[model samples]
Target: MLDPLAALRTPDDPPCDVYLTGSVFLDIIFTGLDSAPVRGTESWARGMGSSPGGVANMATALARLGLRTSLAAAFGDDKYGEYCWESLEHGEGIDLSLSRTVPGWHSPVTVSMAYEGERTMVTHGHEAPPEESAPCDPPLARACVAALRPGEGQGWIAAAARRGSRVFADVGWDETGRWDPGDLADLEHCEAFLPNAEEAMRYTRTDCPRAAARRLAEKVPLAVVTMGSEGACAVDGGSGENAEVPAVAVEALDPTGAGDVFVAGFVTGTLAGWPLADRLAFGCLTAALSVQEFGGSLSAPGWAEVAAWWQHVRSFDDQGRAALRRYAFLDALLPGPARPWPLRRAVPTIGFRRV
Candidate 1:
């Protein structure tokens, strides 16, 4: 297993760089598949793994990037809850002091099937605790990562913003087809609002990603729309400047948590005071590296992997060099060529032999 935390900052650090608030889930991932299973056919996966999911994926990604990360979420008293809590606190070095585990409640779970560079997931969860009755104290970190919901999210976001926290807000796909822009009222208190291409377009009533991003930018300080293979585009609401970054080329294994990783990368770049283009480039790079592996939180690439990739890319000829110049911010993060962590599971699970 790779020890990404070996170079982490001291535990006594005052406040973390990012604070995340969302549901914590146990993800059981099945990998090494060429295609989806047919009806009534029993398909066997070559590999199986499990790890923390949901906002935990973002926390792990941020921590892997050397950011002091903290998470505040309710958990269950079950063994799976303990497993996730311990993994986040000890394994990833995330500060979970503000998180709590409720009695009798079970942690949410997601079963993900990975095939052909994509994932099909089925999630199971109990009714969440009321948002008004938070389990623990809220964190006041440099940035806050959260999902926007109607009755929830905005309260803490407004509170965090009042105290100068940069709120990085994201939204999930709305199956309800009620992609009402008013649902995003929380953006008024957010520093940046990021949504996938489909979500953005639907929310903005636009047919194009660029138009969606530009429209959303009018409501928030920054708006970003992520298009899987097409890359990402962003609009700065204040200066009206817009930028686009192409997706990094990679053989994606599982697309699960790529969006969360992208947000983590963008937050990391933003906290480092990088320019808009560099921030988007770094975000795209971080996410591309993630889909090359398996599992959600476990698949995030550490600084070592990033540094190593930069070193390899720099040796490319003129054509490749021009294409890679967008990732120039990497030089500032890594001064020299560095070794890449061996591609292996950060959190591995025992598997059963096929019959």
Candidate 2:
């Protein structure tokens, strides 16, 4: 079979392979704790990190996978904004040609506290006055990751789909108790819709994850519901083929961006035309590796890490390797044994300050 990725090759340097758009924020993360914070108690964290957050998480993950990713979002003219813009564009190699900076506005900020495998986040930002029109003009790419809001992004998602772009849409948790499926009308424009188990259940008014996945599959071409620890399930609306992959087991340090990293892996596999089971397996591994580190965007593993893990799994003795046989598909995706893919250190989480 011809490689789907080969058709996407570009003569120009760094052609956009994936286009992403959504809110951008600087994230301050606090890790290392035995339990949740007690009010009025001064607690010290073992480690602290700060990096560009929100959509930056997905952008960084995609870029680390060697995809030419572009982000279209608004930034502030403030120092924090400049720092985030530089980190994502220069450090992560994400294309920022479509982004904008608004003078007098301050960049959004999120403070995340990771304790006992999960995290709690608090965000702060002022809503800028609405522009006469929407801020983004959709860019053409082989695939697009759409950050959805009720009544927003519908047009752009449709336009991207009309142009044959694969749209993978993710929605935020609805604060209102009403998780109406009517709000998901935009799913018609998306090639795939990825929602966590809770969100999927709420949206579908289903009692369980599998039921939610089935209901979602009824709407979109593909439906994936992420069940933390339990792994994820996907159903193809066209063929009615459904599959689930178990989560890769690992000692998690922080689970901040695991979901986004999973999506990035799935997106990479989808773009490469990998089999559905392989795509889900790859996503699970990507997320498993991500939680072994701290911070959001900076924690994502690169292709080098994937290659290293593949080698490590194969080198295990028969008894040790028995558990990882499920991931044998990784062997085909990895570099040849003679070709060494060196693992590079992850980008440090740098505080945003204009210097």
RMSD of each: 4.2, 3.5
The sequence of per-residue lDDT tens digits that candidate 2 reaches over residues 1-355 is 1122665576752357899987889888888877888899987888777778899999998888877799988898997799889889987779998888988999999888999888888999986555567744477788999877854446788888887788999888887767888888888889999899999999988889988999999999999989989999999989999999888778888898899999999999999888898888888889999888777787888867876777776777763385367787766655643222442223335542458
Clashes per candidate, residues 3 or more apart or on different chains: 0, 0
Q: Write the per-residue lDDT of candidate 1 for residues 1-355, one digit (tens) a residue.
A: 2322334446654387788888899998888877887889998988777888988899999988878888888888997898888788977789988788888899899989999867788999996676466643356677888798743445777888887788899998776778878777788889899999998999888999999999999899999999999889999999998999999888877788999999988988887777898889888989999987777798888877887778778888774586567877666567543334563353455233459
Candidate 2 ranges with C-alpha deviation above 4 Å: 1-14, 129-137, 151-153, 317-324, 336-355
Worst 10 residues of 1 by lDDT: 1-10
Tell me how many residue pairs clash in candidate 1. Answer: 0
Scored against the true structure, residue 321 in model 2 reaches a CA lDDT of 81
